[model samples]
Target chain A: MKPKYTSLQLFALTALRVSIGWHFFYEGFTKLLNPNWSSAGYLNDSQGWFAGLFHAIAGNQSLLAAADFLNVWGLIAVGVGLLIGIFSRYAALGGMLLLAFYYLSHPPLMNASYSLPSEGSYLWINKNIIELFALWLVFLFNTSSIIGIDRLLKRK
Target chain B: MSNDAENSKLLGRRNLLKALATVPLLGTLTYAGLKKHSNTAANNVEVLNALGFPKNTGLSIKPGAVGTIIHNNNPHIRLGFIGVGGRGRHLMQCAGFAPPEYVQDWMDKHAENPDDNRYQNFLEQDDLNVSVIAVCDVFDEHARLALEAASNADKKGQKDFKGITVKRYKTYQELIADKDIDAVVIATPDHWHAPIAIAAANAGKHVYVEKPMTNNVAETYELKDAVIKSGIAFQVGHQGRQTESYIRAKEVLDKGVLGKISLIEVTTNRNSPNGAWVYDLHPLATPDTIDWKQFLGNAPEIPFSPERFFRWRCWWDYASGLSGDLLTHEFDAINQVMNLGIPHSCVASGGVYFYKDGREVPDVFQAVFEYPNRDLTFLYSASLASERHRGKVFMGHDGSMDMDGVTSVYVDRASIKYKDLLDRNLVNPDEPALTFSSATGNIDAITSPTAKYFAKRGLLYTYRDGKRYDAAHLHIREWLDAIRNKQQPSCDIQQGFEEAMIAHMATISYREGVKTYWDAEKEMIVKGNSVKM
Candidate 1:
């Protein structure tokens, strides 16, 4: 038996999910609106180990073009799924995985340029972890009992 | 009945949550208000956009009509000059330096020629003349160069400065005692300004002392007394006061162009330590002709280090750290435009985060000055690792004018929308247009247009006929002209003392770690440790 959420907890989950979904969906929509845009400029400017990966990706313009399209589609799909509360757990897991790949690729927190690793990198608590936990907690509780379209559809 | 009780409880909880949400918003508003309240002025002129109201507006002056145009050479008193160093030298060869007579004349002839090299070359030369002057140091090298440049004015065939001769002085004392010299241009190092100024005033000669008036506060009072007693003409070298852009800014503010100005922020950005204040040490900075004793005059006596003499600004002993070097210029403009003489109190906080070359002066500093009456606050700040902000921003109740030495006035456009009473609620409520980045294109519509318009307008500046002739040339002209006509110089001794006092007080405040109050009547610091005076 799973514990059910109070109305406040349900509202908090819904707000977080919607915010994350919109953030991604907006990013995708903007890129789609401007088809000439690419990550090539940023990749060229980038240095260190990431430089190799960026160069490799930028070299195959056609393949990277497809990847760019997929990246936008993936963001929109994940955002809609989370916002609708349909496949919410799966969406959260996929979002985390995608973000982790980016986090590893760029690793803004890890400044490899500095003499000492501890002196350089800025490692604050990642928001992805918080969202991941939120997703798990939502899965444990029965959100269908709360005030959402999910609950209405189940009742019908 | 039972349902009503539950409904009331639910309503009460909702109201409590709303109240909780209001706390941060209220806190932010109050913080901003407090900042504004701290910066009010004593006069009727509210601190409009941190820059005061434009003193005078577009009452176009018809040529030769009342207040329209004063002949540069029409002044009853002529100017005589002494030190022709960095600023002094530029003033000397103004005609030859840039905007050559040929260029200006050519521009007038070919007014439609935008693509001509003559115009671009003219602008370039005009900018070159504004290079910071280097007056004679203890050594003969800088002085020799200055004299060479001063004498070369004749070679350029400038007719206005036909008869002025360049005279070199091995020592400033020799130049001061000369009978023909009526006024002196003191452009020595930061520490030497006060003693030389006092000596000049006491010797019955008027003075045009450069910016960062004095090294400390006590000298300010001494210099003030000397000038007052001598009754000589004195002009503080805040050239910005005589510029058109700053004057125009004052006019725009006075007209309530930005509505009731509230917050003023002045910022300088440098991405490197040297850009901030790192003085490069020259290998040849020895105590021989370097005048180590003279350089450290009233500053705390320490062992003769070459760095201390050459790059005195980096050390506290030879300079007022940051305040004297940069803050003086900002304060002078602020005071001139806003008429903000003395602040009620000032609190500053910052540290030297870059350049670990054992320099004592803070590399970065931010200080807030509070004034009385309507909320008027002056924020002064600088950083070595970033370059986002500029010299100053005067924020008003309605709009803000972002300004600095480079840009005269940058008015925010969102402020313009406030004129329509019906549009009051629509300002910040508009739906933000979606973009690839967080940057909304609408904000660009507000800020960039004005920047472009102002850029095209360029500098609308005019100098007195003999402007930038050479310190000695101008000083000599003023002196001889004054002697011939029995009149006063442009900047009298008293004015020099007052300008110098601002710098002195700034140094005292930074040194004592307290807000040093200026007693204008007594011309001394009213509170804190009584320094030298």
Candidate 2:
């Protein structure tokens, strides 16, 4: 029982989803191609609330490899699912969870700092949090079902 | 056509369009990703060529390729220690021996916290196939502890370890003369390092003595002769020679990356009583429990004081203080890279500025050496009251290198050698030109200040097969490998002689209040105005 959207609203929302999906896909794809890429550096530089957990994962090789694996492939799976509106609701939620991890691991706290540079200064809200918010809206809206593969599936 | 047929055909077309609408974008993404990848690779080659490193593939000297080559049939070396103090025990641990209590404690630490990898690294250390058979220390307590550690050759828990007869030789001479011992690790005071090593070398046992390898120039010459005459493997304990970053530093220096190097500044910063060598007097130390006369060993004859016995580094009679104790390390690290063998002249100055304790050695000191041939100056400085690390820096006309745990290079702003790079914005003066990590053999461009921060911390290291190697352990392993393979170690007696001479020159300069000069042609420390001004 979602609310109806105007054609313009639907187009804009769909474009936002596709853009985010493309960004996630490219990031994960590049990491997959780079044989030496690992999440160790980013995890070691993790600050804020979940630093302890992140550092622990980074210290152990096996756990670090698993974390790197999940991070790379999870992004790809979520991106592909969201792109074509295949299980678009679940994909949106998964993307939100990943964003939450990123936000918490290195949140823009007033006193805390990061060794990984940010593109811009922020206060309690970075690009990760912004994307998470956008994904939340994407989850609430039904543009994907209206004009996506979900539309064709809905016929059956 | 019927109305139902027309409606069905239109619905099928709309559904087909909707279901596959964004699929074409995936094809477009593939094209873009492929294009970006190829462009990045081409850009990398262009940058390499611009830097005049077209042939550079990876590390100039890959540690994996030239690292310790442990033969399958390596001999089992029987080791005996002359001193079992803190440093002595660490050397023993590096040689694959740790007391049962420490073994259990390490295990407990790992069990309490999974992230504690010290115990894990100890376990993963290669079995050097060696055992301690004899130990000699002036103190009763240290000798007893050495015996306990020696018997735990397996480096395992208490239950797993069975006892062995670790003979406690009351004197180093007795320990060296033991027929069963194949090598002697001399970790005694500076005064005892040469005499004991000389005696051990004469006794046909290989020697690994701590640095400053000898207390004076005379001893240095005599020890070199004795080692050569004995025909035994001799290694000086400069563990930094085994440090991966330092190895890479040498390779880079040989390439003349820091062109026209004019100055090399090395520093030591510490702030603690222990750091100042004000070690606590052992409560158990007494004339009955300690060999006072034996500990004197050519030092001035005096009534035994527990402070003198425990804090021997604070005295001129036993050790050469900051010059020989600390500065030798910095000097040797430079020597390892630049091969600045023996400086032409040295001038040193300092006093007991920070620690007011009745110690002959200065707590803050500095020394400068002139390498006239190379047109370079080496400056060394120290402060025992400050913990701020002013790292070792090699300054040059083209660039500068700052080395400690990592080596980072920064191009000079007005560098003519790199003028093209600067103008093209390929390299930045404010940012690091390159950050080299020996762990991965990768030189990364520092694009941001944040990346530079992490680069300094050396966070790029990943576990090599989930095992960590200690530099000291590697040093000991190399010595053993040399012994087995019948080759001289990296820091052989020849290198040790140079280290001792330079360190002695600094010591003599500070003590005599005059500039000291090493007449390399005559191998003499000319004290007066013997050299041309």
Candidate 3:
């Protein structure tokens, strides 16, 4: 297949995927090493429409444990998959879903509130939603075959 | 759109569908794992109860008959006084101990007004049947003064307490050994509190020990075990346990009025030298009068300095410093309202900044305790050099409670969960939705400077039927009633153990310069080492 996009555009798209992969990998790795760490505090302080659902999960010990394991491992799996450009599209899909859950847990919609200090103000969109869209672009562009391990595998 | 972009979008859509299909499979696996690993629903109820919210709205072991004295037609409980210093003298007074000169002076000071509540309460002490049969102290003057006060109970104009004879003992062991003494009140230095209480428990005598309940973590566990084995009534001296505002706060908390508390801030402040534990050394506290050896029981033997004898709270050898002397009060008060047993880990930092005297404890301190399981954090701070009063603040998602002298719950203006309630005026936003104030009349009417300060801060007492009752008196009455009823007092040994462990963790963290943790399985404080402040 002949190259479709300019080289610079392809490079930018690959860089975005790598950067997001690094962010997810670091978060998961840090949490994995800290045995006592839990997401209960964040879930318990969830705001907006899904607050009750988040609280219910937080209150359920078994459910919370499962959620913590899945969340941490899923982040690592997706990050590694995306970083190596193996199953990159699937990684983007999984990342977007996780980001959606984060957005729903504490949506930045107007009038939604939280007691914890915020880093910045947002109306209807925040970092999670923005990253979800960025992941979508990465998934649509399918740059893995252009410069990633997917290209080497295809050559075989 | 470009043909290449369209082709990419089609490919992405196909891939998204395949990935999305795996989510439900993962969800099913997760559900199966949770079902296999999670505790039963019934177990969650127990976990929630352990997290400080029991099914019972009232945490009191015995709920009704809080302030009333039930005679049960039993003989007056024989009581003994141990370590009768400032706090001991106060407890003695609460138990109807008043010398003739003291009563007469109080009456004269109050202009002989028969309606004066303090004097009136003394006159109405016919119902408090506790008879002080023994007095003990290492200090001769303290023991003598306690004996004199106990002997002059008739001076309160109460005919029932006439001609009482209180025998004096030179040591707590002798006092506890007395056959006639049915119960013992311990208001000694922190080092002596647990030893005397444990001995009293083993001697088949009820105990009322001052807080912090033990000098160290090991003593706390030992005292708790002794009390449980002995099955005697044990009350830790956290008088605020009986405060009306705390009871009301507990009720409100049980009702979930201030939903899901995540953070609590408690503070203590004092400006006077005496409040900083620079207590006055009695002029007669010489080596001849004070049995310095007896007073230094289990503590390092130091030359008899009147400062160490009178102000032992300033030293680590005899006390837990601010953690035991002051933080315990704040912790107990909050515990009564919130039932916060203990924190998982604590980090503390402080130092002796103000009083340059040769004291060992810090004059300013701050500690943060993290409760990972409960998803809560408690912050405690104290300063002896500043008079700026900071009360306890419980911050929750729906509302926040500010409890200083009064208890007030304010709805969070930006509360998403309670937005509809706020909009419909179900929860008011302008003012506190619930307010509990113990003050009813003019604050100046309270004569004692101490009483005035407490009343101003809503700490000393609470009003019932338009009449004020001292929290200490109420607390003592509760202990006596528990003894007669064979029920647990408000602040029992288990509760005391929890309070002491947390307080000791803060002290240890500050002294050892490390984060402290509770080893629940071992029932000990982790990384705890006794370091001089």
iRMSD values, candidates in order = 15.2, 2.6, 17.1
Which number leads on DockQ? 2
Tens digit of per-residue lDDT, candidate 3, span B385-409: 9998778888988778777556666
Instruction: Work out the iRMS of candidate 1.
Output: 15.2
Q: In candidate 2, which residue ranges exceed 4 Å CA deviation?
A: A1-3, A47-52, A107-113, A117-127, B1-40, B50-52, B55-60, B159-164, B445-452, B460-467
- Tens-place lDDT digits, model 3, residues A26-112: 567656654444666568768888887888787566989998998999898877666657678899999999999999998987787
lDDT of 1 by residue, B1-533 (tens): 99999999997566444324323432453355445433321211222222333213312321112111222333333223344434455544442332134334556555664333344433433221211122344644445545544444333323443432456565667767777665566665677777888888898876767667777767777887887788776656655554333554565566675677766777667786566555566555566646666556677778888666555677766666667777776776766667676565466667778766777777788777666554677778877678765646777655555444223333344555344421432222131110011111111111222233323233211223312112233333443344344555443444445455555555555656776665545645655534322
In angstroms, give how far residue B500 of model 1 lies from its true place.
4.1
Cα lDDT tens digits, model 2, B28-72, are 876898788766656555645544445357555554544564665
**Deviation of model 2 at B195, angstroms:** 0.9
Per lDDT, the best of the predicted structures is 2
Question: Candidate 2: what lDDT?
Answer: 0.83
lDDT (Cα atoms) of all candidates against the true structure? 0.52, 0.83, 0.76
Report the alpha-carbon TM-score of model 2 versus the true structure: 0.92
Better of 1 and 2 by TM-score: 2
- The segments of candidate 3 whose C-alpha lies over 4 angstroms from its true place after superposition are A1-156, B1-73, B112-117, B156-164, B424-430, B438-461, B528-533
Candidate 2 chain B: minimum summed lDDT over ten consecutive residues — where?
B459-468
